[model samples]
Target: MDRFVLTDAQWAKMEPHCLGKPTDPGRSGANNRLFLEAVLWIVRTGSPWRDLPATFGNWSTAFRRFRDWREADVFKRIFDALTEEPDMEYAMVDATIVKVHRHGQGAKGGLRARPLAVPKAA
Candidate 1:
């Protein structure tokens, strides 16, 4: 219902391992439909897990599942499985390009680098 649900085509594009499978009895529970929906929402909207809508189930539950999946190497496996292999025959080629006038890489600044301006007393 107006949730960031994944279309059939998109779901099919994902790795089979990432898809929901038949859950066993007892230890098995309600399908993780809402959980997957929440994850899809996050991937689509790039929002934090805590920002997940309550309608998609508890944010903590979704986060826990995410963590579990991550710990179980599900994410990597999914990525590998869904990814297509490059089409290239057995061939080795190398090329080198020369460039002049190179500058040092920029440094990353931290929060400490940015300070709020102090207001003057009126």
Candidate 2:
């Protein structure tokens, strides 16, 4: 399989947070690192679940696993475990709060169907 960029240190940090571990009650995941890489591929590429490559295993299974993890707060724990204190040095503006420049504005009136004027017979 192609290298997924997840280093050993990173995987170490994330390992405990994942489900289907051998120590856990039910079936252990086939390969957690591979599954994570598959998930990362989907997230990075913003592709639909159905488009997941065969190398990742069944797309439906991966998606179902993803959904289960999401509901279980597994991802949230992983983020909390991996992230350090947020950097406040840079100020960020909300996109909704920004005003559009005049040149960037759309047509003066909002889009709507205007009644067609009937030509009068001369």
Root-mean-square deviation per candidate = 16.1, 9.6
In candidate 2, the residue pairs with backbone N, CA or C atoms under 3 Å apart (3 or more residues apart, or in different chains) clash, namely none
Alpha carbon deviation, residue 36, candidate 1 (Å): 3.0
Q: Write the per-residue lDDT of candidate 1 for residues 1-122, one digit (tens) a residue.
A: 56446666656665366534556442113355556677778998999988998887778877877887778777687667555664555454444444433343344542356567889889
User: How many residue pairs in model 2 have overlapping backbones?
Assistant: 0
RMSD of 2: 9.6
* TM-score computed on alpha carbons, candidate 2: 0.65
| Best by the TM-score measure | 2
Tens digit per residue, CA lDDT, model 2, 1-122: 85776999989999988888755553236577888898899999999999999998899888888888889899899999888555666567777779888767887766789888989889
**TM-score, candidate number 1:** 0.52
Lowest-sum lDDT 10-residue window in model 2: 21-30
Candidate 2, position 117, lDDT: 94
